[model samples]
Target chain A: MENENMNKITINIGPVHPSTHGVLKFVVEIDQDTIKKVEPEIGFVHRGVEKMAEMKYFNSFMPIADKLDYISALNWEVLYATTIENALGITVPPRAVYIRTLMCEMQRMMSHLLFLAHVGEDLGNTTLFMWGFRERELLMDLTEEVSGGRLAPMYVSIGGLYYDLPEGFSEKLLSTLSVIESKVKNEYRAMSYENGLFKMRTVGVGIISREQILKYGITGPNIRASGIKRDLRKDEPYLAYDKIDFDVVTEKAGDAYARFMVRVNEILESIRMIRQVIKDMPTGDVKVKVPWIFKIPPKYTFVRQETPRGEAAMYLVTNDDQKPYRLKIRAPSFYTLQAVKELFVGSKVADLVAILGSLDPVPGEIDR
Target chain B: MESSDTIKGRFPTLLSDVPSTNKNETVILLNDKSKLKTVVGEIKNHFDILFMLMVVDKPPKVFEMNYVFTNYSKNDILTLRVNIDRNKPSVDSISNLLGSADWEEREVYDMFGISFKGHKDLRRILLPEDWPGRPLRKDFQVTDEVRNWTGLDLKF
Candidate 1:
């Protein structure tokens, strides 16, 4: 028998709100407080970065890349830089490679920290939010020490990085890492992870299957959480990842808790990687000079890199012009969000924010 | 690379019809736009995911559509390049074939104004519905009306 309360109704959640994160609108059709269909409307923040790419010169577009995924700005900067470098057939030196790698891993850690913080707040745990940001600020300080910019740092150039590390940067970084490692392992574990109520909120909820990962073209930590054992850093071996040794973490459950576990483990793994990069650091020139008005000869150049969110890639088609003929940015979140209907359909209305946080999608790239 | 050979071997009959160009061996040029579904359906098993859908405006006449397909197990990339006439450009949507193609085809339609005939919800996914002109198109010249008109009449 259908109860009086079991009628179907629609509820809209913000093109502007906290949980949806940066100008995303979600329409959830509910049947007795259970999600029947979830439709996420994107592009509230779309500035047409692709169209802007067609107008800007090869070198001029590097700073704009930082805007796409400001959470992990360095990764996008590296990706955009690598695209032009590949098109121009320029190889970055070993030192530059290691520097890019170190900075990228740090950005990954920063991204995950914010994810943990936001997800904690979503769960109504304000203490975890404060703790997450507390640890994240240390890394932020280190990045600012080098680049002098917080959040969206325009540190990477076409050939390599904008500048090399300072004299005591490595020493300061090692100290900062040690502090982060201890806090993450101890405080974070106690606050949210090991807490029974938190686990109950997350465990076995918002399950995205392995088949769905491939179907929706979900990548990065999202796919890894589903136990696919695929990471672009290991698979393609871009930057200095091939040289460094680290494990690609995975979980069989494909639940919200599994995704959370993957990000936490990945943070530790990134710390380990940073240590390796610092130790095996080669001394050489940080950047090679590429002209500002350079042109990539007529060709279709595609570059894919693993950002904190997912497999963010850029497809550039050049035709002997100062600007790209046509540029297409394949934001992984765009694909990741496509599976929202599948993820939300059967879940309780209260668990929506928890499920969303587990995915760790930033809308900057999605709306770019 | 052996991966290229493996690709050819994986789908022998299809490759024989559509020749791969020199820009990259993975890219296969499909001359017939109508046969997109049959070809995708046949090769769908080999390609685990539709990695990306890239539609380029080739200035004077053609709209070159590149469908990048990737296999997770084999770690291989195969691009199916299909070209359509610029005037009244339309093609069969492969959203039913690959779930990943759902949003991509919509995005292509929104930006390039290339209609995917069979897409279920074909509304503008990015720009305001009332916004004039396809912005990604090469001939997208900003008119006074388009530039100045505030997006207040977004009822559509």
Candidate 2:
């Protein structure tokens, strides 16, 4: 008789759903249109990069790291390179730092642009999806100009970049960024932010409080959207972030709408940082010469970087070997997905997609 | 500095006296695994966030578990390290205190076969169910079947 009261129907959402954004599957238990529990069953796309990192040389692992987060590949590359450089006590040139910083900001913008488009599409407002990608192409052009690749570009190296910035690259970037800035201001604001349908679908749904955020280890824009001023770039500045001035955007509502707004504002902030980086751009050698056989001393170091998604950390252990003894990737999405289990409880089934989109779990990084 | 002094003053028995290797970060290695929950609970009360949890395999019957906690207010990171027996690696789960540990503890169990005693659910995360052995272990050898599946003829 007691078991009859606990009759919750299980509904499998993904593993191949369009809204999942990747190969993420969720076994959501619902009781008549209301979600009782959501169990995210990931690992469908686990490539075991950590095990593979153990076999590759210190510098050879950069490409592997690039595959961790494809949307912001440069950031992952920079994170791995800096971790190795820090372990070896290699001082990156100021010019190189500025260049890396510029690229990172651009990458952040690129990621947030995608997030905006994705969330917009998820909420049935296709205007943002169309306009955001149109603006993102301009950023991609600058990316190709600097890194020589469109996506999955492993630009940052151990000592510095693969090469120095191209001549007149700053001018081109400035021009492109200004164009992007205009579109974001006029077009995106008029289309998505003010759209009535977009507001209704997102507002007051999938709400996450500050306590829930801390309990689940959710970070980046998601936590910031919950009204917590916890951006690693602000809390613990890295890669020229200390030199720049930008506000850590936050939204107190902690709902799907707030998360969307936070990323939208973050895109604007990234543009500001990119503009500052170009203005204060130092002049020097981008790439420094290092020994062919790069061997780090026996030590363990953990380095964290504020990626577009959240705080991504690399824990490296080297036993005086050419390759790392162990490499542990602390991806933000891993915990975010964990929090999804609780995010769906007591909400209408319609809110599941909005919550999933708002959380923004990159399955590649989460499953890595 | 205040947090470091406070931890040192409080857990004099559990924390090692050795100075931290990293300048700004504080690293403490706990000698006992039984008191992990107690010490971690105290740390959570001290810090605002649990930054990361990682397991390191120190071969020949020893595994080291590292829990990194951060005080966001002061921008300080405190890493707590605990060593357990490699033969049967298990520690008290901290997921109850820090909700973030739910997935991470499962991940450690999946890769290294190091289980968390009090965890509600412990299952293979990054690999398929019924997969032969823990792939992250030092003694884990690559099977020919896996190599064939990966399209590589190399064997370990």
Candidate 3:
């Protein structure tokens, strides 16, 4: 009778659990110790972001964009502002582009740091989490030093950034990057992939095929892990990415461990990219001259760039007004969340948390 | 009908079919309902990525749905738009072809009150289940009573 009851046990693991990292829930149907089916229950924290865009002016919507993926706030702001600028046929100054690229790369590093910390904590390695957060705090300080706010730095304006880098900004950022680079490497070697138990838990688990990745529209590090050599920075070349030099990391395994390793490698690459930007830092005007209340032309445009998780896309439709007629944010986590059902179908219940942590999804991006 | 012009030079159907209204992007208009699925399949076979699907509300009771496909190999984007009547807005769900369309179609259904036939899991995604009207529709009204967030008679 106990065995019979175990066959039909269904567990709902939060729109509010600590392991979720944000507002997201998974209804897992299990048989014995193995997961039979995983139903993703989302929209718990939906603020109607798309509908809100329709009411606010195009420029005013920047603050709202900051709320989507609050962890990587600059990445969200830059992508949306660049989309609007692209639609308006405006040219952002070279300095502005460089600054945007610097911030984007920094944001990528910060986001990966958070991912590392949380994934460590999820796997019961609390020491790695502390180390990860310590480095991430240094990055956050750099971000706040430049942009003013610690979390939602509404620094990137529509045409360009709100202001230029402050005094001693380069020195401060360089030191932080150096410290994080060495510290992250040390932590990875001591507590992460180099450790046997960590490898045992992550390797050959929650495997996804390359064909399935393509079928599901997966991008960013997730796609890269499946041996795909596509990076928006390298291919599309937005916001001074063309000028910067960095390698696109890949792992052929296409497993949870591969995803983790790919992200680990990406942090090093971001450090390299940021160092290049700082070394060749250009001096010019940061903000483009534009009216306070600018009206967009009657046209529709779709813009996308590589976010840390995947491809973050913004769709903008304007109707000769200061406000956008319609706006849609194609968040990467939203797409990645769907793949969980397929991933957890055959995995054991104990490995479910590991798989979820490996995905590194920001539920704000998913639920927004 | 195999002239030298026809043999040596076939006009680029993909380029010629693109509507002129698209300034920065290419838009394809599909009129035949029966060809919708096949056209999407063909585009998918060629492009290998379908990025987004959205419903556009055209004035005077006409709805236009767009399927955006981006070809990573060719570095080109093609958008297919299908028009339907607002009174009976329905379209065949392409979730079978493009995996990402699953939730996007559900979102369209929730917002625009359009019906996607053959969708496996059709339900309100962003809005509450008991929500009365489709908020994205032009006809949907938000009364003062409904807009009040903190009151005894608040209706969400």
- lDDT tens digits by residue: candidate 3, B46-76: 6666777766676678887878776454445
Q: Which pairs of residues collide in model 1?
A: none
User: Predictions ranked by lDDT, top down?
Assistant: 1, 2, 3
Candidate 2 residue lDDT tens string, A1-368: 76755777888988896383888888888888998888889888888899888888987888889989888898899999989888998899999999999989899899888888888778777888888788888889888887788888778988998888888988888888888888888888787777787788889988887777778778889988888888889878888999999999999999998999998889889889988988998888887887766788888878888998898999899999998999999898887878877778999888788889998889889888
Return whichever of 1 and 3 wins on TM-score.
Answer: 1
Q: A340, model 2: CA deviation in Å? A: 1.0
Whole-structure CA lDDT of model 3: 0.81
Cα-based lDDT at residue A164, candidate 2: 86
Residue A341's lDDT within candidate 1 is: 76
Best by DockQ: 2
Q: Listing every candidate in turn, what is its Cα RMSD in Å to the true structure after a full C-alpha superposition? A: 2.6, 2.8, 3.7
Ranking by TM-score: 2, 1, 3
Predicted structure with the largest lDDT when compared to the true one: 1
TM value for model 1 = 0.95
Interface RMSD of each: 2.3, 1.5, 2.2
Query: Least accurate stretch of 10 residues (summed lDDT) in model 2 chain A?
Result: A1-10
lDDT of model 2, residue A275 = 88
Q: Which pairs in model 3 have colliding backbones?
A: A14-A25
